[model samples]
Target: MLVNKNRSSAGFALPTVIVASVVAMMLLLVAASASTAIREGLYAQHYRRLAREAAESGVVLASKCLELNNDLAQWSNSAKLRPNTDCKGAVVAGRTQYIQQDGNVRTTFEVGEPERREGSIQRITAVGRTELIRTTDGAVWKSYEYRLAGQAGLSTLLDSVSFGYATGGGFAMSGAFFTVIDEFGRPRSAGFNGFGQLGVGSTTDTLTLKQFNIPANKRAVRTYTNFLSHGRNMFALTENGEVWGAGLNNHGQIGNPGQSVAWVTNPVQFALPSTDNVATFVAPLGIVTFVVTSQGNVYAAGLNEKGVAGINSTAATIKTPTRVPFPEKIRADAHSWALDSQTAYAIGESGAVYGWGNNEFGQLAQGDINERRAPVRLGDFGKPGKTKAVQLAFDGDTVYIRDSAGAVYSAGKTNYGQAGVPTFRLRAGVSNRCLAAVGASLRTENCSSTAANQKWHLDRTNNALQVESNPGASQNRCVEATGHNGEETRMRWCAWWSGGKRFDFRYPTNSWSYVYLSNSTDIGGRGLCIIEANSATGDTKMDSCEYYTHKVYAPYNPTLEQVASSGVVDITTDQYFATMVYANGEVKTFGLNNGALGNGVYVDTSNFDTYKRQAYNPTPVKFILPPGVKAVSSWTTSNGVDSKNGNTFVVTSDGRVFGAGSNVTGQLGIGHIGGGTNGIYPTPQQMLVLGAQGNLASYVRSGYGTTVVYANNRKVFTVGNNSNGQLGDDTTTTNPTPRANKNTNPQRHVKFY
Candidate 1:
């Protein structure tokens, strides 16, 4: 039994010991897991903070690079972002966009993730295009620099043209729909095929006819070719919605650039913030251009047959494109027309097309003939594409336009192609069919046969050619000279009214001229007026007398006004004069001498007058004095003497003082004297009081007639003119030099009653 019990106890001990060992092992594992978790959490938090800091550093680096290379042309098209570019180890890595691949350029964006474990580590990787074009074109520069923050917008009509004239040269265009001038004197136009002006590839001058390679959409324009420009350059547009121009000035129009000659010649892409250039407006057709020019600015240039040239007359010329006044950044939706270099017809962004400029042909649309150099509203054409443009073309001699959606019209010189109808002459000698056809062909050839001297007339009675007039033809059929007393020949355009019965060429009877026309008719209209060449009538006399007068008076105005009583001679003049009165009782003047209460100086004098003129007028009384007078002051006496010598005092300019005249009782401040000779001193005497503290041993009151003297400490002295105790020493004694006052309870010093 004892042996079995001991065995049982040993088995129990073994099991118990094993169980305790297992529990202790389990507790150790749990503690290790918890500690590991806490350490890992801390490591992760630190890594995240560093990662964020690295990212912020990258952003700052990018911004700095942008600023550093802001003025560089390459920056305009360069799309490289280098975060690792930071040398301070702030940014672990950086990502860039738009890198070069092979021979091509493209755009790409990248990102960098920070790996912070062994200090600060980061990985930079980019997944985007790797090519880009680098050139600083006007459009690109404008977009890049003008971009506020990160975006930029363009507004208003665009034009293209060029010009040459006297005075400072310049080009014109529109920005934000406002007419503006560029650096070049030439008007802005797409005549120069370079610099992507017409959005075309080649840069050449095609005067006769040529096609433009502008893409159907506007956004693609800039993408096709990029250019770089630096300094004094310019660009402009026409009134025909066509942008043209040339200028790269660093001053005035184009702002301050660093270099010179940044001329641009082509219709660059421009669009406002909310609109897409590719979506709204119609793309320019082949070889067609729209042009706009103006003295008041606001010009467009491009193709538009619907009277978009803004040329209201036929005699005017659009030398170049320019800006027009419109709401800033607002797209102009209305139509316009130019009558001449001076006048224009504009349909406001909301109003009708008004005519202005040289209104010699009644082009002002006011039913009268008068030269105007501004815009005037024509009949309303608010309905969509429909416009009240009577005729919108230039006939070397006149302007032609049909009513809105009506027949063709004409205005100005009707000698050649002025009248778009046939003309007739005497066919008596030739009855052959061939001759008749030739004659008819010539008349209908848009020419007046200047060599033949024959009238271009249509058959009003038979709707066919007439050999001769029937004795009494309406004089209205005849082209007559009008305006300026027959100085201007009126162009008559034939109209087939009354079912082709009466054929009368209609021409503007008044004067105005045309500067630009749309891209529809030749001479009259056909393509946009890229650059409207000036007419032979270009007169530097474009200025009027009233204009000169207005300018002259613009800066003239009065700067001062004088307030004067009934008869006061209060002179009003610039305050640049100085006046001097002399002891000789004369006034001397220097400078402008506006006006003062002094004697007048002689106006005229000999050349030998060297600072020498009449000293003064009313001679002053002289008070002789010894060479060394200390102080001076005037005094009065109780004798009631109103003598001039009694009221005088002098302090020499050399620090000496002297006194003279009246001495009622030492009032002259000299020693006391007898009443008669004492009070009538003509000679000035010196007062010596150097020993008195705060030594005011003596003083005189010339204006009010009184004298006083005060000692250093608290002593007081008085004399002179004591009619009412004028001398404040408690006593009414009118003494002179240094009198002592011991009357008042030693309280008050002195008083001038």
Candidate 2:
């Protein structure tokens, strides 16, 4: 029984052993499967992360390419897709593959067409995909879609011109010219090119626009010209803040120690102080030249008569630059400076006017004709009730001061209607008839025995005018000019209740006898004017003021509403606030602080009684920027103020460029630099680049004294100020140096690095 029991037990043991072995094998197989699954999952995650990283790298590369060249068309070209090279060609269109680490990592990216939206905003869609990797059951790829938006850079294709102006006898007759940019950023000139001010390398004047030689990588960012004399000197501030002077250096205005009485044909660089950057350069219509460093220190050179150089009386000729001694550290906000032949003016951030040099005509506004050797306080600005003086304009012996109220005042030489007071009346030269409001139409009729209808009153309280029937009595109706359907002029009722019943009176010429009456509602005087009807009645009506020969009589009043009509007048038409025109065609006329017009800022005037004002706009109208424009800056006049009549250069969001306004000095960058053809463009003009294959303008700046533009490849082109090689053309021909055989076309191009 024991043996049989043992056998049975052994058999049972064997079966149990076999069952245990099978269970062990099943557990091992399950563990192996689980381990393999975990491994596969980890691999998939790693490959996915790598693919995402690769897509991100592709996006970064594309962003860099766009930064270097913002042109979408160029970015879409396959030739430009090389990762090793600078985006010289256009951007890649379709997907382009990039492989790394022996095919372990790969990415493909594609850029979609750019969409230009309003407000100079541009959007681009880019898709990037990583190489496919094996998964548990199939293959998978990672991708990232990105929407990139930015303000477009400047464009490469556009009509553009660079213009400049030199000081002349008066504001009406400044020496101005222009130069046009070709498809590749080359420049040509037209207009006044005397004394090689145009930097074209020759003094021969051309009646038509012509091309000028320019150096590579040298372009003007700011321009300056002399103000008070015919010895108009030209200066250019390059994109790098290097200054060059040409023409009229008889007084060593070119900053060279021995360069006197010579006309510099090419631009010569100025030996500026060791400062890193120059904030601004002021070469007023005088023999002296001033420079303001970023540190706010002022430097001067040229003739030191009356201590105009701001150095000392001992130096008669400032052969080199010297610092100016101010009573206190100059305020950082003091960015503007104006000079006449005899006086210099500067305004501090505190709104204090500083005067030096000659004060013979009270140009300093110090209430006396005492000359100042150094900067001295001239006006009671920043006071409790006073408006700050924002800008200054000089005409012959007179000084025109523009305040925060948008009103201009004269401190010197009030003759020739500089005081804003009308010296003449609108008496008919033919029938001895006077301008009278007959019903709703203006007509030439017999003057009232008491000069009632003949007498007109300027209501300066609100910048309006009234035609009174009595000397001292108020009339409900004012004189107004109106036209219907763009037809001939007709007289209309300008009731006091009418919201836009204001008129702007201006003297187009030096003569005070004749004036121009434009409706305040009409900016730029487009088809709005007060003119004499051609009929036998000689009736005055509101017609197209486009006739440059039309003239009217000044309104007479018993009490002086304001100063006489003289110098420059900027009226607050349309809106009582300020307006700003940006490069992106965005215009904001309201929400401006005092002196915030023309890229300048004034001290806050919330506590002052003086009204806040902006730079005077003859026509208070909004300006539309060219398509794709993102930025704009106006040309600085000789007075260191941006003139509405001067040029405005614009840079497109995609790096294109255009210009508008006065092209007298080829500052507009258009190809009209010579030929006495002074173009006053009312709208933006496209700027072409010479030799620009596909290069686009990345930046633009205007100093009415000079003009400059820059391209994507870092190449620069300048058209003004070659006297001191400020344009970096490597030649110097000073003005008034006899026949130096220098280029006088203001539109001449100079290449700058």
Candidate 3:
């Protein structure tokens, strides 16, 4: 066909326009592809950065593990045990993970077991991973290495913990990592910031376990929490024995002269005296802090609190630390609890046990309840006499005294029978007349030991009164109400009247434990006080006993008396009873029994006669130990608040351990709990039975109701409560039986390492 030239030109222009459009579309496609690749690279870098941070956290924790003598399983935040996590030759020591909402984005780290080498260097491996999507193509993984080595000549490692019941959550000791981990195994150090007790550098609460900045040369050794601290005040003692305080300072308790805000978020080294190094510290809560210098001088600061500080001033609170006028220099010391009340005991360099301060319950055993302004000799200790006190423990309103002859005596609040077997006569706070049995009838008579019928002992099993024909007589009678409010108390054989003679004691003050007769119909809120019937030698009658200075043994310090008395801030203050392993290989418990005493009196303690039976008298714990086994040290378990009732474990000279007392939490390490009235072994049971050789590990630690020991070739062996994975056995199961560590090699292991 023939084509015209004019028609060919029009078709040629349309083809050129199509080619131009195609070139623009290709450029746009190329630009879009380049932008997508850039975004992918950014995402990969972001994940990698997160992985790096996780790896860093793991290495820090691993370094701590090395510092703690290579014991990796004693942490509450230990990663849940997983087999073969990111290492072929190395075993996993710790693992943790962080995740963003619904686990869409996550970062994780796993620490390998530390390997010790020459030059004191430790090799640590950490595996870090991140994921935006659940696929290898969208994930990042990396391994980071860390070398943890001690100073060339360093030879000491301190792994310790200090705990006390306080209004706030609590403070952590220096050697232990007090990290509260989240459900994802991520550690959190944040808590209530009202008083800055966490020492995280700000009053603002943060979840990350922030570092407590201190001098590189200084390390924390002990933690102290004020028993009456409303704002959660706390302080730490350094390895050099200098005080470093944090949190609330409202009474200048932290030695910060002008804390305008009344607290600190960061720890500040205390303004200690420049002259001497510290020998020890006594912090029984409240506002006072006592420091005993190595030269044996006593210094104190903060609230006098019954003159316990011994500064001879009655000021509201001592703003500066001052030396006390105590007579003699002391080697060891202990004190009582409470803010408005206190008592302190010290063992003089001459072996005399001296006491001062509040004596509301005759806890100082000076034959009276008068508060001492300064130190006074209570008795001699470690002397060569049966009556002399050899060892002493002061807590609450009681003092536990152990004699050289092996007899134990408790002097303190006998209210509710906590002071053990001693019986007393109830003297009317108003009339001064004592409750006495006048020829089978109850009457208010003059208080006297000669009034044999007046001696009344509490039936701890049922809170009933037991009056005897004479003191220590076999015949017993109980006091009860004959009729209504205006009638006399009826005297009947304890079993003659089935009405169940029950009486309750209530606290009216720091020293008065008031009584309430349970059967009285005209019951006042507290109890029917036997007020004067005629203002003369009053005929015993029931009347209202409330808020009056009308009784003996009043209790006002709201915490457990036993816990207050037995506490020490430097070491484990959670112990309830005073346990001693005699030189003769016998283990004895003295102080408030509360079923933890293991003295063949299976204390069910579940209430009843007014209160549970308790004993402060020293009692023996029977154990069927091997012939060569002789007692050595003792470890007792208690939180002092929630776990006030406790268990006892005794280490023998032959590397074996004997356990006794309450087993409700299986804290006795007996494999199986005793099926008794209170799930306790009234007698001691051999739990940690090892070789007959003296290979027993010396380090043993107990928390709440758990016990940990390094016995099987030094590999960590955990027994007792594991409800929170605190045993570090990689399991949450609370099996009473002891658990072996994951990479448990041949070694003996016990914590408090």
Candidate 4:
């Protein structure tokens, strides 16, 4: 019995030990599973953070690309993306991927169509996806996707058309549309689409503007239009300084070689002298075209009848653009061309105006009827002691020239009084009306030529003119009218007169001989003049003058102020503030100030920097060329004082550039800020670009706080504020120092293609 009991105990102990070992193994398995789960959770959190960062970086990169290549047409093309090894190119349409630190992290980005809304707002969408390592299973990976939508900086170019003398019968209308460069540097158009001048790839017209179909990476800077009789031709300049043309190719006015006389519906790039950049272009009416280069040279193409092309040749039709030999370098700042039916005129940099082609009606202002094949110096106004012709305008058979003094002089046919010195006097060969002081009614009677009532004299006053009766008599009194009513004339003491004693005169028509006399103190506030009630010898009375039709020639002396206030001055006189007279008898400035006086600032002489110590000038001072600046190439200024932050930029001969006024955003291109100031360059400073040959700059343009310039080597450089990536440097990150909000200097722009 004892042996059997001992065997049972041994068996029981063996079974209990096996059960404990099984429980221990179960506990070990549970601990291992918990540790693996914790490790995976940590890995996922880290990768998620990295993926988010990668996505944000991709967004910035994509935005840079869009800013450079504003054309949405080819945005989906991989070649247009311009991706490098760092970005790994686009994986799909409008998408680009990047691998960071070898294979550790991968990020991809996709861009969506841009939506332009009213009021200059453009919305853009971007999506970014990142792939991250998650588990040892290698096949299983973690993916993080991010989306961003933001406002894009865009600029819109609006269509504009200007007619020359539309109301005066010199009407010339252009069915041409303009190409505008948006803020992103893309070309957009609106307006007359006849002959595909709008550049929308079709001849269909559009009242609403649309974008152009062109290379996705190209940016246009300037556009030109030539209104022909049947169709209008257009020209565009790219940011790379390349020239392109579209529309009517008839007569080779489009500048394209070997092109048929067919209309071009889209822009076609053309080549000129590859080394020279086009500075200015003009397409006057007819089949002629002119182009000015940065090198101070002028070129012409197309019809050459009467040698209107200025090529010094009588070729009936010139097929391509050829250089026109000028006597002197053409001023890039003020150089321009004006065309009439049979003649052409050009202005040189030295303030010399030249004329070519027909001079039948003295349209060339050369004093005689002589046509020339080459440019001839205009002798009428370009002489010493006279104002230079800064700008010119044509009115059919007449040519109107505006001098630096803002005075307008016309030459050509005068059959309808279209050209001549303005004259204001009584109508000749008509019975004169005589007025005398007789009660409240100013009665007018047929005059005896020698009577005192008919022989009146004018006297000048502080702000008006006084008509004196019987100046030869001892008691000469002031002659006054009652006003618009047919009231009798009365004599008053000149010193004690109340209101009607003073009179003002103005011209009511384009005719130089028409004049209207308005009473200053008249109760009815109407012009007073003699009106015939019946026959030529019948009773006459002072009555309301029909301003639009009534006119009289009175040899009344006047002052400069009177002429300006007469409201009869031409448009040029009304626009310019100061006139600049050149030594060569050429008036280079037409007293008009567009806020771009180019004399450093916009303020009058009284507000000049040295005004407190020097005499104040009532007119704008002449814009003295800098020491080395022989001539002005091009100039631009901020809109006006209303802009608040105004600035000026001037490109000069010899490829030098200068800036004045506000430099808050480094728009001056001087590369540094003023001491203790926000970089406001009140005076002119030479602009400099680092790493450029001779530090020379060729072309320049400016906005609120941004400045763009082209180097002599064909490279583009930018300076100033870049908060909106306007600098085109592939980054929105701004300079940390200086103003803390701007670059405070210039940087080279990245290549878009």
- On TM-score, the leading prediction is 3
Candidate 3 segments whose C-alpha is farther than 4 A from its true place: 1-156, 159-198, 202-211, 217-241, 260-262, 276-286, 332-341, 380-390, 403-407, 425-539, 542-580, 588-594, 599-606, 610-630, 635-645, 656-753
Instruction: Tell me the RMSD of model 3 versus the true structure.
Output: 15.2
Indicate which candidate wins on lDDT: 3
Better of 1 and 2 by lDDT: 2
TM-score of each: 0.22, 0.41, 0.56, 0.41
Per-residue CA lDDT of model 3 for 120-167, tens digit only, reads 334455556665554556544432222222211112112222222233
lDDT of 1 at 745: 10
**Comparing 2 and 3 by lDDT, which wins?**
3
* Candidate no. 3 TM-score: 0.56
**Selected candidate, larger TM-score, 2 vs 3:** 3
163-257: candidate 1 lDDT, tens digit per residue: 11111113333110001112111221222232223323343432222223222221111011101011112233222233322232111122112
User: What is the Å distance of residue 738 in model 3 from its true position?
Assistant: 6.2
lDDT of 1 at 171: 35
Give the poorly placed runs of model 2, Cα more than 4 Å off. 1-107, 110-162, 166-175, 178-192, 199-221, 226-231, 238-242, 271-280, 304-317, 329-335, 357-361, 369-373, 382-389, 396-410, 416-753
CA lDDT, every model vs. true structure: 0.28, 0.48, 0.51, 0.47
Q: What is the Cα-based lDDT of residue 215 in candidate 4? A: 65
Instruction: Score candidate 4 by lDDT.
Output: 0.47
Q: Which is better, 1 or 4, measured by lDDT?
A: 4
Error of 4 at 62 (Å): 16
